[model samples]
Target: MSTSVLQWNLFLLVSSRKEFFYMDIELPASLKLTLSIVNSIPIIISMFGFLGNGKVIHLLGFHIEKNPFTTCTLNLSIADFGVFTSFLHTIGYIDQVDTIVYIYLLVTYFFLFMYNTGQYLLTAISMERCVSVIFPLWHRCHRPPHFSTLVCATIWITSFLLTVICIIIVIFRVTTKPLFYLLLMNAILCLPLMTVSTLVLFIKVCFRSQQRNKGKALTAILLALLFFLFLAFPFTFYVSYCYYFPHLHSLMLIGFGCSSVNSSINPIIYFLVGRRGRKSPSRVSMRAAISRVFKDVGDCTEDKKSRTESKVMI
Candidate 1:
């Protein structure tokens, strides 16, 4: 959901033959303490995300809704749970955790899995959005119902399998190509899809009067994507460039810290946007509100299931 800039804390570890040792870079004492406090902020947001998304999932139950938008949002919420919890461990709280060598590496690898899975998932959502806008008829008529689920499954499985394989390689003294590829994959996959999503939104949806109903809704999504792109830029650049100038590591950490702000802001967006007045049609549930916003120009079917059940207070 945050479009996942990994903690960049991997640079903080050294995999020795028997064990992985930590190499702490000493920033100023005040800076470290400030970071610790700042770092705790995401946990609050993460909790909100977990519960907020959890509520949406509960409303849907075992049934998959017709909206791929809801499907992607659900997956994103699941990823957020992983992102938030794993994220907590990598922050200033690291020293407090039990750090048995293999255990620590497993945790590290799991964090990698969650973060990258989220990033890939966001890209998947972007690609889907692009297709929905560009070829609405095809999306509604020909697109497989399970396509979003499949995309989510692909992201999760690939992220997990690749992370485990890469961790095994790192732990057993194999080539570092896995790590290289991990960074490369993160850098490459997201931007193109996001760019297309944004371009398509601005070009086709933003200015068109016929799309008025979906405009606010689509704009909400686009704003989030744009914010993520803005936040992701320096961090992505640092991930590539830090290989040469290691001093940039600190800057990356700062960039990472700023990037985490997205986690906090996201749930706020949903809550704020989903809010409704006393006399409004219904209390805004994420699914119903989004489905309402995205009600297409030509399609007549509204997601009435969500609209009727939309008693969710926030």
Candidate 2:
């Protein structure tokens, strides 16, 4: 779950080729100590991330105004929290004890589901913002009030079904091929969609638009997307590649470390973006900062303003 389930399956498959099992693979004492130290770093970092995400969830869900973007962010924080919680399982430690392995597998299923749901929700957030910018009139006049909530619910359901199907495939057929393709499909579909949507927002809103304010909201979204693409994507690509070259198993810790950083960085991004122009960072409360990020005119007000400005110019 924290790592790919496919990675575990491939590890089992690799035992057929070489002595890859933890009990079988012999390492020097120094290397084992180094790996153990490196592994602990993520756990410490993830604890901070878990706390930060919890704070974000509390503020966004309870304190901020209810808008589509805030709704998306609240869910995003929950997903990140789940990621850190599930990462607590020591899947890397292969014990002869069956109880530990069973626990790891159980946690893995939920991890995959949450990770996939987060990816889809992020894509939806970016795409929705881009559309509102590109087609302002349509966005104001025709968009449903609860559209974001509906999309998020749909994403959760779809992710659950897909993860269940993957588990079923492994249980019955004992192959990793289905899960591998599923990961490949997610990377192929969601990443490009996010990239394109984010790019459009930058070009239209940041580079060329005539809005009086770019606002902390858009700034927060842009920063978050940038961090995810740079920090988390290494792990995403690594899992896809590791299936073929299981010899690169040594780098798995590094990959997970990158992901943990990505998972934990969003709250910091929001705070910094929201703290802009303030005389002192400590003076700005978290609730005030987050509210500034989610502040935007209502659909009707924005549409009316647009029409009035157009008539005056003409």
Candidate 3:
């Protein structure tokens, strides 16, 4: 079955003529390599951060804390990492014309879909934050950590199911019309949600005096949303064109390249304008308090052991 799938993917790659290798305008190989390396930076940083701090934080039971922002950001980083890795594989196979290359392309398609879904999830997170800030009372009643987790889980599961459905549809139908429809549906559904979330975030930032310093935060979200929109819009249009006019294969290839840029931009935005770089003294103090609590627990445990030994000796 795996070999059959691989063969089918390779057939798709060869027959479609829209693989990433062939471009209309000549781009220097060195420039392409440079761009690919630059784009991979965000994925690298986010993967490391997500793997490093994310696990430690979760192990410390901090995942259940009242910080929806942190939890959502962590999940976003993981999703970004997934998107990045997938795109990196695609980039690596840009010149290859083999079954393995097609497999990488197939994986890239899956991750592109995943990346779109992740954008929606991130927008949902922003909406949750907006509600919490703008409607604090209602947010308290409705948007607790458990509620957020449930929503996040639902987004993930729904995305996975949807991706599976898309793959099944593609495999069975094998027609361009369905692909166009699928891409259009995804774009129409996601773009508006992202736009609204970005707007709400902006409004929330503007209204809240305390959050005025969060201009950078608002900008980051806006930039990320714009990045997504820019990448997705062209891909959607290219897919539509491919359905109607298959000769425009080079356009499709370029669109994929542009879309690859989206996966690499989120972590850079976060690092530059998001929470990681903006850690205030209050956050440091909170970390210190947590460390102290752990130390106190250890000291109590040691004291209990010592007392038990003394009692036994007596």
Best by the lDDT measure: 2
lDDT tens readout by residue for model 1, 1-314:
11122233432344323333643334466655666665566666566656665655554445434465666666766765665566655553444333433444555567567667766777777777777778866665566756778888888888888888887776676764465567677778677778878888777655686845555546656766776677754555665665556555566665554445554445445545444322564666666654454344213224333433574533
lDDT of each: 0.58, 0.71, 0.55
Local error of candidate 1 at residue 279 (angstroms):
7.7
Between candidates 2 and 3, name the one with more favorable TM-score: 2
Clashes of 2: 0
Candidate 1 — which residues are off by over 4 angstroms? 1-12, 16-38, 42-66, 91-93, 97-103, 275-314
Choose 1 or 2, whichever is better by TM-score. Answer: 2
RMSD of each: 7.1, 5.0, 10.7
Query: How many residue pairs clash in each candidate at the backbone level?
Result: 0, 0, 0
Tell me the tens digit of each residue's lDDT in model 3 across 1-314: 11212223343444345443343334467755654555465345445534443443443345223344444555665676566566545545544433355465467466655666676676776666556556755655444435657777787887777666766655555553444566677778766777787677766655767633435545566666778777756867775675566555567655655555665665555444433333473354334432332332234334555766898999
Give the candidates in order of TM-score, highest first: 2, 1, 3
Q: Any runs in candidate 2 off by more than 4 Å, and if so which?
A: 1-36, 91-98, 208-214, 297-314
User: What ranking emerges by lDDT with the best candidate at the front?
Assistant: 2, 1, 3
Q: Write the per-residue lDDT of candidate 2 for residues 158-215, one digit (tens) a residue.
A: 9989988887776665565665677788889988988988798677657754543445
How large an RMSD does model 3 have?
10.7
Global Cα lDDT for candidate 1: 0.58
